[model samples]
Target: MNQLSTNWVLGHKVTPYQTTGNYNLVKGESPAGAQGPPPHIHKKYEEVFFILQGQMEFVLDGRQSTVTAGELVNIPSGCLHTFSNTSDESCLWLNIHSPKGFQSFFDAFGVPESEKDAMQQSLAAERITDVLKRAREFDMEIKIP
Candidate 1:
């Protein structure tokens, strides 16, 4: 219901929008070499991703796939997955999760992009640990390692 703001979340710039009980949407930009969240599953939500620029590498159910601009990936609920911007340049993408709630995770842990050193803080060990601790509250079963 409120306007979404952008935040630096785990080495990426994320803007969560269109959040509702039905679904949550986000636009993101990841710098080269940015490794996304660890492999995880959402037992109650299906996820989709649309790549807008550059390329991204994704692991879905143990199968690795390279998605490029204009490509899309659909991950069913309970699938094991993770992603990384493995290209030599930054990549832009959009994501959506059905049966909304995951947006709360980003909102709670993401550093306001407007902060002077948001990028640095977003990846800090302590901040990551805190985020990881509460991940399950948002339906995330993160695989730490």
Candidate 2:
């Protein structure tokens, strides 16, 4: 398990790669009131989110819905989607992306929990900007709103 800290509220546990170019799974946790990434669309991959703990509010293609533990949400390619922890407790969820490769985005922008010095180095290297600049290379498009 590779632990990733994307920010104060978002944490990710990346499962080891088992098959190349097939799929990627990431276990994610967010504190209450935490907001996810800005609405975004993937041109090449389909994404699925499974709620494992608290509730989350998902906005998909301008529609908002609440998903609780044991529920799942699927966002197809080219759909705009984002999610947030709406309950007053931390929410645990799984993010699965088909056709793999989305893990590369997390690897590039997320800070490894055990590597504090690496985090600092990444920060100094302007990782977020780099992520935005390189997003298309991973078949992702981030929308600003």
lDDT of each: 0.91, 0.73
Separate clash counts for every candidate: 0, 0
Best by lDDT: 1
In candidate 2, which residue pairs clash?
Answer: none
The pairs that clash in candidate 1 are none
Residue 56 C-alpha lDDT in model 2: 94
Question: Model 1, range 2-46, lDDT digits (tens) per residue?
Answer: 558899998999998775468898999999999989899899989
Question: Which one wins on TM-score?
Answer: 1
- Alpha carbon lDDT of residue 60, candidate 1? 95
Query: For each candidate, what TM-score against the reference?
Result: 0.93, 0.78
Measured by C-alpha RMSD in angstroms, how accurate is candidate 1? 1.7
lDDT, candidate 2, 22-109, per-residue tens = 7887777776776666688998999999999989999999999999999999999999988887678988888889987877777666
Model 1 error, position 118 (Å):
0.5
